[model samples]
Target: MKFQQPLRNWGGSLVILCLLLYLTLGANSLEPLLGPLAPENAPAIYARNSFIDLVGWHLLLVLIAISAAAVIAILAALFVSRPVGADFLPLARSLANLGQTLPPVAVLALAVPAVGFGSWPTLIALFLYGLLPIFENTLAGLGSVPTTVKDAARGLGMSPLQRFWQVELPLALPLIITGIRLSVIISIGTATIGSTVAAKGLGEVIIAGILTDNLAFVLHGGLIVALMAMLLDGLFVKLERRFATV
Candidate 1:
């Protein structure tokens, strides 16, 4: 396990280093191939910001949105998985389903009028779009805990709260983390669209490219986002394995 940990860390680190090298040194070389660069035809490479700024802010927004969504999902799952709150599961599921079914663009469109554009609207959209998977996975994980194990905890004089905190949560953690991973990766891709609402993100680059027919901008943005998603997914896989082996 110790050996495996270093291997995983190295793998993730290598991917990140490669991505950074590309963003810093390789992106410029690909510009000619990605699109025409005439002054009249091309969009300014990044429009308003540097590549590092774009990637940094995009990731920051995504991190904030996904963290919020994960917290909400976990709390909701904890509440609804309990016997006292079991009856509300159907309602909770319905709401989470609704969040998924409504297109994120539509959510953004609706949110902008109320939230007045920018990161807030984007955050709202991502949070809503990310809820279902995490909620469902948390519910499944918590519900999957063996009854006998629970009974054993009771036999040992553990309180309900103690059992849940010490035993059930640890067992359920891997699945819950998986849910978070899914939600985060989904959010990473979806968040690129946030640029349309005047929120700062890689999506701005892609959208600018589309409007101006500059494929270089689009490719750069997509590459950054794809690398980010892969990096995060890899990290989460490591985290899930760590929790599972515990």
Candidate 2:
């Protein structure tokens, strides 16, 4: 029963992982299936870089970017939600808003001259693009805590920090997780554009397909990206529900 439950819980993850493995490891083997999808004179496979390597690098860049954005956003939200830090709320919101206001491609274009090409520019763009949703959701989660609950925590002689950790944060975690989910999905989609700057990612395949008119390459890259987003989103949804029940 335990094994069965676990299998059921991870069914989607397993399926996607299997598909990703088949697509990446057996891409060349797919010539029969994908041959018809390739435009005349264009290759059926994206062979410039191994699809697996591109997927790995893409995930790595996103992980780094989203981790940074989440930390900064959550901390900023925490500070601004505090009474002593209330005055800085507008500034914090404005900072987060500014990041989301600009398109990721623009950020990448502007960042390239400053940092040059490759993963760093992509990281910068993803970090900036991912900031707003997490920041806003954190703020909303903290704000949603009931005044009565705060009073109750204080009535128990808990310190502000203790109350936040034990009470407020627990209540707010679900929404914060939701924000992270949104940020993750956005970062995944935006990360595709990073390949334009010589950053390693699934975008390499998509961009190559566009340039060469290879529909197979485009579909292959887009499929992986979409699957990754769905998997992460499902995991986050589970976390959100788990925390909400607590």
Candidate 3:
């Protein structure tokens, strides 16, 4: 597990660092790329007062959405990657194709009727949209497990479970992480759409901006979402590198 140590260390450290950065920005509105934080409407309300709520709640929505997607992804990976005859692969591919082809907004629209607005529908739409990346990568990683390794495990009288756990899964971890990275980034961006349903997310800022023609609010919201996505992606990359076999 020595090879995994660096990944664990860096993954934890990077998240901590990003958290610190987020806290700093929350406290001070540090990033100038988003322009001024705008003056609050009251005497006691500081210029950046809303920034704290915006950043905090936006992050909360992202985590909630990502968690929903993760559950979908993990279940899909478990079910889809199993040794179903080669026949099942094409079905997975076709389904993934369809999933990706449907616009997320359309999915949200369709879901809104059934699920009836709010974060639940938004969460479901994002999870469905994310399914392709996770499913495809799981299939690819499982398929690409080396024949020699499989043979060696079998030759040693290892059970299928043992071989998969000890060899195939470990090797496939990087690809799985890649899929998760894609999913997380997409989730973060898509989360903003939740605001359409009156679900709080960074999208509120964008929606507010549009309603009032406030460019600064839009930029502020959009920039934070982008930063959060980039930060998470960097952490994933570090995890991938750390776990990558030397």
Best-matching candidate per lDDT: 2
Best by TM-score: 2
**Whole-model Cα lDDT of every candidate shown, in order:** 0.81, 0.85, 0.69
TM-score to native of every candidate shown = 0.86, 0.90, 0.77
TM-score of 3: 0.77
Instruction: Order the candidate numbers by lDDT, best to worst.
Output: 2, 1, 3
Candidate 3: where is the Cα deviation over 4 Å? Answer: 1-56, 85-87
- The residue-by-residue lDDT of candidate 1 on 1-246, one tens digit each, is 446554247566586869766774566666555656424665435647777778788888888888898899889999998788889989997887776777767877888998897899888888887878899889888888999999999999999999999989999999999998988887887778878889988888888878877667777777778777877777887899999999
lDDT-better candidate, 1 vs 2: 2
- Cα displacement (Å) at residue 109, model 1: 2.3
Comparing 1 and 3 on lDDT, the stronger one? 1
List the lowest-lDDT window of 10 residues for candidate 3: 40-49
In model 1, which regions exceed 4 Å deviation?
A: 1-13, 24-44
Candidate 3 CA-lDDT value: 0.69
| Pairs in steric clash, model 1 | none
- For candidate 2, lDDT tens digit of each residue in 98-201? 76777767877888898998888889888877888999999999999999999999999999889989999899999999999988988888789888998889
Model 2 segments more than 4 A misplaced: 1-10, 94-99
